[model samples]
Target: QVCPGVTPPTGAVKVTPGHSPQDLALARAHGLPLLSVIADDGTLRPPGGGWLQ
Candidate 1:
């Protein structure tokens, strides 16, 4: 599906496997890797780092 106000040939949805259940299911169906970016304390972990916090 195309997003409103988005031009043709450039429409895409970003899947956040760690955050959304739907995205996680999509990722799993597509054999995509699941990455953890948030820690138990709600802090950003490695790879994401403090820059994103």
Candidate 2:
């Protein structure tokens, strides 16, 4: 997953531990946001809170 302000290289794909489709689907079904990193204040990073209701 990409950091809040970090730039990833071209064609870069952040593969975290639970990036599988099954895991994603499961998290989606449960209304949970999938996250790889968080802010220093404990806030979920981008692409993470989107799944939250």
Candidate 3:
């Protein structure tokens, strides 16, 4: 965990392992900053961060 104790960034999505790249791209194009791409083992990772304010 990079920042274990720190609060998670707002507007973050914990994506499942099966989420498609097309969905990811759409989210990004629509300004979805915080993308949580899941691994095969159900591990969640933050690829980027976005501001909702």
Candidate 4:
């Protein structure tokens, strides 16, 4: 966990596994920065029409 008054290194990327639209919406509503990452055909994908559907 990141400590208060401390900053992570540059170009740091944080990911949340198994994220869904409802989860994304709720996170956004609460002003949380979240990006959906999904697994497809042995690869990872970002949020899209198929993800939302």
Best by TM-score: 1
Minimal lDDT window, size 10, model 1: 2-11
Higher lDDT: candidate 1 or 4?
1
Candidate order (TM-score):
1, 2, 4, 3
Q: Which stretches of candidate 3 lie over 4 Å from their true place?
A: 1-18, 37-53
The segments of candidate 2 whose C-alpha lies over 4 angstroms from its true place after superposition are: 1-18, 38-53
Over 4 Å off in model 4, which ranges? 1-18, 35-53
Task: Name every residue pair that clashes in candidate 2.
Answer: none
Off by over 4 Å in 1: none
Q: Model 3: which residue pairs collide?
A: none
TM-score per candidate, chains pooled:
0.66, 0.33, 0.29, 0.30
- C-alpha RMSD between model 3 and the true structure: 12.5
- Model 2, 1-53: lDDT tens per residue? 44565555355444443658866766778677566756678777666655652
lDDT of 3 by residue, 1-53 (tens): 34455576455555433377776776677776553555566655445222321
Model 1 lDDT per residue over 1-53, tens place: 66777766585679998788999999999999887877899788977876775
- Compared with the true structure, all predictions reach lDDT values of 0.83, 0.61, 0.53, 0.55
RMSD from true fold, candidate 4: 8.4
Among all windows of 10 consecutive residues in model 4, the one with the lowest summed lDDT is: 9-18
| Residue-level lDDT tens digits of model 4 in 1-53 | 55555465355434342356676666667677655454656455655445554
TM-score of 3: 0.29
Better of 1 and 2 by TM-score: 1
Candidate 2 has an lDDT of: 0.61
* lDDT leader: 1
